[model samples]
Target: MRNQVLLIIVLLSALLGAPVATTAAEGISISETVLKMPLADDVSMDDAVDSMKLRANTLNFKLVAHLPLYKELEAMDIETNRIEIFQFCDARIANEMVIFNPDFSAYLPCRITLLEDADGKPWLVTLDLGKIIPSANLSPELLEKAKMVRDKIESIMQAGANGEL
Candidate 1:
């Protein structure tokens, strides 16, 4: 039965032309939709992004780009100042992952977004790398890199949530 399911997943992946997530029996989950961390009242968007930048640097993740979506939209006449995304990556870790599974490129340069709600409260939303990386069928070396990257990402977000530098 498990083999049959695996076959189906493989077939679907082949048709889609991208790696598909595999799930274990008994309804075991291997991935998450989004992880949210509430921001304190005193933490502005600028402050959060700056904190993330410092933390990412300390963790050895290069800051690829910081997208200011709110400003872009506002320039087009949308009223907003609350959506931004931080893109960071560790080339060593990414190279290890890509050498084994090039499909990992789909998630390269991990992005953590800062979103503000209507009530003026901010939140951090990010893909759960802890779940995604483990399920990627990576090699031992890539797996170790994944673990380290995941830990660093979580730490960065935690610092941002607590309004810490």
Candidate 2:
């Protein structure tokens, strides 16, 4: 009986130890795209982007923990960065362009992270938007659109983890 129990433990550990694979969010085949953005001479854009990435990871972990379809997401190997466009990509969703707010001491309208890839394109990711900008109402329409986008991204990530991507 002891030997059977030991065998079961070993099997469980082996399965649990296996790496959970994940692909980029949004079914977006994010092969190391190198995008570079012009940075203010004195600012640390890279560091700011890194900070946002950390927050994104935390957000993803929390979401996974809360959602049933993404329990395995806690173990996912994922990455993200910030991207900016001169013209908005999805204007229907958000009219205002999202940018990095380096300082957040008093009141922040938006929290921005500029992520740079090997090639140097900076992707701008954001969070804490509502708190940062307490005065302005983030449109309900935009929020719902954002939720849809997030769901699609999560789906893609799960598919990637399952080697379906």
Candidate 3:
């Protein structure tokens, strides 16, 4: 079953011409971009884009651009603010939470999502799940931290989504 899913992902990537590594300005280097934005309870879309433009030079982060789904996240909310960025590398190294790492690569796979409302504002949301998804060789410690980050976003979104300023 696992092999089947892996095959499907690979096949889809091939069909879509998705590269394992990408360097596009529109949606790469998200971690670095999130880091640049100011930490505010409320942030605007223009602010997020301006921050991305300003700090584009300092980002070394990389990710394959998944278009349709990525665009869909925008419909979720407009006033998106980066809740947080978890570097699975550093988190694992510090043994901060419960996780599972197999190769001990010092980190786990990362997933980045964007929060946005109808207004078109965006918040870059990042999470390092710490190899929780089977075959992962990571310390359990990091997993907890990853969950914490995820939960934090959930809480923030709940409040923001409800217009609870």
* Full ranking by TM-score: 1, 3, 2
How close to the true structure is residue 129 of candidate 2, measured as C-alpha lDDT?
Answer: 30
Give the alpha carbon lDDT tens digit for every residue of 62-104 in model 2.
Answer: 2221111122333464332333211112322333323222222
- C-alpha root-mean-square deviation, candidate 2: 18.9
- Per-residue alpha-carbon lDDT of model 1 for 1-165, expressed as tens digits? 563464344333322223355445535322234466888778876788888888988888898988787888889998874787788898877777777767677677887878776666688877677666657787786678788888888889988887789
Best by lDDT: 1
Q: Report lDDT (Cα) of residue 38, candidate 3.
A: 22
lDDT of 3 by residue, 1-165 (tens): 543444334333322233444357433322322211122446554344334333321232222233334334457854332322222122433333332323333223333333442343444443323223334433465545555544443343333233333
Runs off by more than 4 Å, candidate 3 = 1-42, 52-56, 62-111, 117-123, 130-135, 138-165
Q: Per the 3 Å backbone cut-off, how many clashing residue pairs does candidate 2 have?
A: 12
- The lDDT per prediction is 0.72, 0.31, 0.36
- By the TM-score metric, which is better: model 1 or model 3? 1
lDDT of 2 at 124: 34
